[model samples]
Target: MGTGAVYLTLSNLKNHPDFLTKVEIVFFCLNIILFVTNSTILLLQLVLFRQQFVRLVLDPVKGVFVPLIVLSFATIIIGIINYLVVPGHLTFEFVYVAFWIYIAFALMVCIPMLMIWFNSSHDIKTFTPAWAFLVFPLMLVGIVAINVLRVFPLLDPRAINVLLVGYIFQGLGFFVTFFYLTLYILRVMTTGFLEGHQANGAFVACGPPGFTALALIKLGEASRVILPQFGLVSETAGEVFYATAVMGSLMLLGLALFFFVFGVIPYWFKVHKHLNEILGCWALTFPNVGFVVTFRALGDVFQSQLFWTAHAVFTYSICALFVILFSLTIFAIVRGEVLFAKEKDLWADIMPEEQKRLTDNAASFGTDTVSTLDIVHLGGRKLSVDGFSEVDLEKGERRPYANI
Candidate 1:
């Protein structure tokens, strides 16, 4: 999804004379294909593995990511608006319908998931920046609304309605994200930085504010044009909205910069230590895309060479990071290190006898050979059949399995 956002934004850069439109289109198309393929796999998993699906949604550590499924669709929708609707290659009615449909989907996913979180017990020490994902789908609604507004005339009723809803969505998403960020700060202050690769999640904290900054500035530009036509308020009210949006966006951008720096600082000390592959490493790419794209928007807003230069530099850096991460991801896939379910992931599906048999087999092979599939519990304590490590879920001390 982050790669798609990067390509989508690059394809929309009308001001950059030297950018290769053909290359951007090619990458965007490839991203769409990948998105569709992954979506199909997830759907298939949900259908064929109902128990795993339930576990994935209810597990405290993993449940926070369920909304990212909605968010991925939101990214695709925004891309359609930018590449298809705005270009007139696709009709406005199609995307407009998609916009409302997406809103319903996002609401259904985010609201229920949030309720589950609220009702469930979680240790604060287990919290990570991934909590920001809870509201990410809602925030992207603001972004989609602004993109959809571009295809309509400023005087059009449709444009006015979109602008209004955009602000409401922005409020819900941004403020809720702020609350999550506050908790994350408290968590960090109490427990210190996340250890090892888990620290990469700090980048996730940058995303909400960075994209909100982009959405606010673009929506503000739309308000400056669209609001005065409605005669619902004084002409100066539109200016006020625009000014407020800019100021709010500036503040949010500063917040995003703090997170970006906070996320990078840990890597400075532990870059070599956490080089092992995990899907979470991809966090390095998409969150920073939000920061880079926000910089691009600021460049356009201020028409400043410095902001534009910063945008260019960051864009290239992120693209380079994307390439490196993509290669590592492919390698991990081939090595069966990611995108494959572990024994623990499917534990709920296994019969008691089958689980015991597997556990016995694992024990017979010795601790050195135990993998994630060899989970066993004695009393209330979770242990690997390998005997090398133990986890107390009540205390939230999760450790990786001894072997892949």
Candidate 2:
């Protein structure tokens, strides 16, 4: 799209043409900035802190996002192809369609296995908002399929059948999202707000409902397109789904928005003066996109200009936010605040000392002493500790073991 816009701009003869050249420029800049920043961070992680990166990948909560990240880019590629590449070539629809099927199926299979593995193998002390990422692929297939169907050829008789298959997964995704949402609420009410960077993770809750809302709208359309043939019900099944889906989505949107504010405002005012340190702040990006798109779906459903206007406002605003976030994230990376770098090296030479800081903080609750003898790593020294120290972190600065 970027190159295409430039080509069109150069070809146009008008002095003040109202062309989409600005969009092209914006996309070009955003693409370059995000690409460079991400590449730089990944490289740094590989070279400077390979072990930490491995630990992160293996981590139960954080690890889930890795494959989800891959799936995210796959969806992005599908979008690029749909909008930028394959519009004129209906034949090429199969290429993206096949790609989507492979990815969607892979996610359907992989997510549950990972969920079982992560939940069983690891002892989860703190449940971060990353958990919501596990279920996103559920709604993802329906979203991509519905949109692509608009332009792509009706290549198969089973397009509706394929959608039915996707609907099953979407249902599964919705259930998982709802289940975890309860856990999340319990964590907040029983445990307290996720401290430090994990607090930003609250933004993740915004995705499931919003994505599901948007997906249902498309699925409703897809059902309306095909459901009449099966004699399951009338064409009104689509409207039924749309009505319930929209109402449910609006409620979820309110909750998601509340959680967004619940997550961000306190951190801004009380916890962290700025969002410079945490990569979990990236949680702000995808979920907001989900909401923005869902709102657009609502506009289509009600045919209301207000919802369309809201969608347009949020779309640009979020893009602007993402761009600003990209800039800050890059700055954070350069400052070495994002890297847990402990040594001085040639590559690390440019990291400014003043800007070096910690970005992530895991909130802690009290732990039980399972045994009298425990091995502890403290200050790079191995200590055989005989007993545990019990202190109310919220209540007292003085530890009972302080004198001992």
Candidate 3:
């Protein structure tokens, strides 16, 4: 999704003389390859490892990320519209149908996953801004709508419907994200920043408002064109909507900035030490892409050289961040740390013998043997070491340790 966002943002610069079409093409192909490879692996996991897949979906710490599956597809759709349909290389009719199809897929996946999270028990102290991912796909609807709207006349019925639905989606996504963010603030105030690499999740908070701002501005641009032709109210109603959208988007951009700063402060203090243990490090990429895209939108809205310069600087910064994170991810994989690490918490419910087998397999692959105590500690479970015994912090009882 992050790569696709970078590609889409660069593709939007087609009118700029310095825009390199080949760079955009490289990113487009890279995005497609990464998306397909990841999707295939996930699909295989679902098919061949159904039990483990179910466990993963129900695991408290990891389950929140399930929505990213749908969100990834949303990026693909946006990329297709912008890179293919907008260029007239692909017919609008195909992407138009794809738009609705993706909407249905996002709703079906995100809604049910949200309900699952609601029905399941979760400790509030374990909450992180990563929960914002649940609504990310829907938030992207407005972006998809704008891209789709580009191929149609401002007065076309199809464009009008897309515009109206975009507003609905934007509202749903933004307000729900607002609610989660409120809880995130409460969680942080009560529990402090999530420890270790998990602190990277804080950056996830920047994504919602950033994308919401981008969507609002783009949708507002659409309204400026479409609403005036419909005779819905005064001829200036479109202008009013556009003005209101700019104000709302600016407010959202401020909120996103707050999160971006909030996420950065921990890094400044050196709170997160394990930078490459998990793929979550990439959280730094997509969220900031939204921020940069919003900056670009404001640049376009005002034609301000300052805003455009800020946008360019940040865009290059994000590109550098992506490269750094990508290199770390590959190194971690080679070291048998991230994808190959057998996280016991994820298999806490497995049979003891099966758990041992997986643990040994991981160790055979040169992965370090991480104790259950370490895994539990990382997960923030209420357990503490008391000499040779393990004490349950919640119950204040010592239990014999089992090495498995």
Candidate 4:
């Protein structure tokens, strides 16, 4: 099926004039290579690290990594379909699938990252929010899959509502978690301490700005679904296309500005505070390039050279950064202790008292100091302890350090 599709894409490319087409067989060849590389890595991980993958990834209640793989596969399928079905137009089918593939690529990163984040061999049973964050992108993936497949009639109509609920909740999940991430960064910053590189990896793994940009784009699409109710526009394909394009273009612009000004710049300056700071710094590297390509849609619509040139630069730059970032992350992961120990020690510094208190308590109470407290509950409760209790106080004798 894939071979037939590739053949069709080649046939379509042959008809277009040499000057009219910027995309070549080489582009498809490169894409195939990337796909194979990612697929091979995933297969190897599932085989060699099956136990670790199950413990660190598949066993989680949220099931983030599997959803991510499903999403990536869906995006790849959709992109291949788009290339075959509508090779000329930069319309919804094309945009939808292309962005999704990039999303998959970004999330594919989290697989190995999750492995590294959960590398503590002491107790495989213990879990952390860092693990939860590692799987967050999968939530978005399930959401997008439902939305697109339903809209495109690739899925059953009865399932549409389920998909919508998935979309809404998935979106809300990202929204709620993102606030905590922001709070986390703020806490680290205010304390004049840095989080472990893995913690920073977990933060970038949450994919705040990228998800927001996608959310905004989705919101614009949702607007098109209800456009005719206002009676301000016709319910025609051309009209829908134009409106979605215009709205998406504007939202993309706003998101690009927000990403660069609010997200990228701040992150770049504070890169030292993060352990895998490069991941956070480079997370937007691909998504922002997609945003730039969205801008190039103007030329695609008009069938002109203007958009094509912009695409060339956007494609090249993003591809370069992707290669560089992937190389750096792989090196860092393999180097493990040497590369990350210094940064992991940074997280140790931030809450030294908390960690120490936990350690002391663990020795006494039989609990680790690194307990996970839900942020909401922490906000609501307030308690103060005067001092430790006496071991034997029946005669009203108090131990100095035991009770006060």
Candidate 5:
């Protein structure tokens, strides 16, 4: 559909000379910018999270960490493909680079699965073992089928169908596995928050979710771009990107506004609440990066005049929620000690008799003592002993006693 749309636009441009050139220039420039920025960000993510990535390769079930690694690698692969294969002249250089990038990502994913299978004691489980097992082989099948079918007339349509089906299955599999892992993380976060275990609470409570947000943005964009070919959605990648950008940006902005209203302003009023302010600040800022990208994508897709207005309102709302939650969390953290102490005192007062008995037992047990003695004859050293008595000592004489 993307190819067809481009062709249609070209056909129409033949009649409209001035507008055509302008539109073409604008499109080209924007495409360049978008591609470069996205590619750069993908690279940065890979480099920044290299350790997390290496761990994923070694042990992919490192919970939420695995998705980010996958996201980074996948995004990079998409970028390379777009740059080398789809955009300009498909030269050998482009083919070589694109092939190598795909190979790297494939290896990153495949090596770990193979290692897991080889190392398993026949009982180990992964995030989604079945999907992992099927994806590699299916990917191979898709690649081989596409290459082989490109040679024969009858095989062309079949190859396209196979490739699309395989990609959909593989992508959907990863998506489901990622979804489950993310939900699990969120559940744990909610549990920690409810139990007032701030120590175990998420550092940002948004790390894994943020990754999902980005994925959602990408998925939405992909749906818009590709779904039309399959005749599913009216939206384009740009449109999807726009929506994701708007929604994600709003959500992130809301969190920041919330921190200020609940945490920062309150802290400013009562300077003693330092911890609350710090945590609040992090909660506000941490997720915005992902959201900003989402917004950028949205802006490209929508190209509407009121986009800024929508952006502002959405940002404010999201920020406001953060403020409320941050305040509530701060209050919870601050009052934990007081609540604990009160409960302890209540129990103590209610069980006075038991406490007294325990105290007595403890004191009596402390006062008691046990003793034992042992005697041995020395074999290595001998001493001549003079026996002395009171009268003998006074007369300066010593006496000895024999056991014989």
Candidate 6:
């Protein structure tokens, strides 16, 4: 819950109101709750698995959110440092470093899983926002952790080292995200909007670019502040990064809007009449969060009334939408309604005959079907049921053969 979306809500609510306003305090408290909740969820998963926590790292799809879980923890620590901790307090600074190490460990585990998922996982046509799972961790340091360092007035070597590492990850994330995004677009060109639950993957496009833009802007800001002390001189660094951020924000905003009109809007039109299983598309929450931050950052850069208006609109719009969706999600979870996709739910886009053939052929049947509809769903929560062999839900991905 403390995903970028949570921070986006907190960012908007906190900034728009006077500090200590009731609304700001509510969001502030909400942020704390969200952080603890996400942490609890992760800890529970680890405890449930016990010694086999190692296997979680090997999981391609579910492992994607591992980074998120870690990043969320990092956000909580830094948020405490930035907003709550006593000013000039060094005691909690070690806590910040601890979370930093935590994220580093998570990246060590999840980054490899991300690469393995892309290269080894089968099915391409159903690709969705799952691709962006790799992008967020790359931005975590530049977007969240670095500010915590700034709280202490970090030295150049330490700060530049941090910035360089984040820059490298962001660049790598961009390459992979762009590569898959090209394939995603081409798939749409050939097959058209991803069918069924997978259609939500389109909104995934909205996040990485905006995230990259914001990350780059932060990198630039850090560079201007810290690089000069290292005898690094680049008069154009700030302008270059800021201009890139403005242009990138607009580009991403256009892309997100395009996906919304063409991808999400059509789904809404039908949803009123037919209540289809809407699952992973809820991922749309965080990308809009990304856009809100993107717009606000760009607005600050250009002092553009237009960006500010967009920012304000998104700020309120996202907060309201987050309230609706987050509530619905929690209600579903509490009621034991299935939140993660079964193979069938995700692979509805797969040719029905093909899915049935796979299902029918598997005689050593289990309760849950296999859906190899596409690459792993983002966050790795959506189990494959389309083309993969039968998944024993009770067993959780104990497939003998990945039929691909």
Question: Quick one: best TM-score, which candidate?
Answer: 1
Where is model 3 more than 4 Å wrong at Cα? 13-19, 268-271, 341-404
How many angstroms is residue 40 displaced in model 4 relative to the true structure, after the best TM-score fit? Answer: 4.7
lDDT of 3 by residue, 1-404 (tens): 66776676665541455456678777878888887898898798778667677877877777778888777777788777766776789887887788788799889988887887788777888788887787888888887787788776677678778889989998898889889899889998998866666677888888888888988888888888888788766889888888998998889889999988888887645345463455877777876667778888898888887778877777777777778877877888887767753555454444567446534544543445544445465564324343454444333345676731
Model 4 bad stretches (over 4 Å): 1-49, 54-71, 87-170, 191-256, 262-284, 287-316, 323-404
Q: How much does candidate 2 score in TM-score?
A: 0.68
Instruction: Judging by lDDT against the true structure, name the best candidate.
Output: 3
Instruction: Evaluate all candidate structures by whole-model CA lDDT and list the values in order.
Output: 0.74, 0.57, 0.75, 0.44, 0.37, 0.58
Compute each candidate's TM-score over C-alphas. 0.83, 0.68, 0.82, 0.44, 0.30, 0.69
Query: What range of 10 consecutive residues in model 4 has the weakest lDDT sum?
Result: 375-384
Please provide, for model 2 over 51-88, each residue's C-alpha lDDT reduced to its tens digit, 9 standing for 90 to 100: 56666666676566655544444444444554455446
Query: Candidate 3, which ten residues in sequence have the lowest lDDT sum?
Result: 380-389
Between candidates 2 and 5, the TM-score winner: 2
User: What TM-score does prediction 1 earn?
Assistant: 0.83
Q: Whose TM-score is higher: candidate 3's or candidate 6's?
A: 3
lDDT of 1 by residue, 97-146 (tens): 88888899999999999898788788888778888787788888888887
User: RMSD to native for every prediction?
Assistant: 8.1, 11.8, 8.5, 14.3, 20.5, 10.8
lDDT of 6: 0.58
Stretches of candidate 5 above 4 Å error? 1-191, 194-290, 304-404
Query: Which is the winner by lDDT between candidate 2 and candidate 4?
Result: 2
Give the clash count for each candidate. Answer: 0, 1, 0, 4, 15, 12
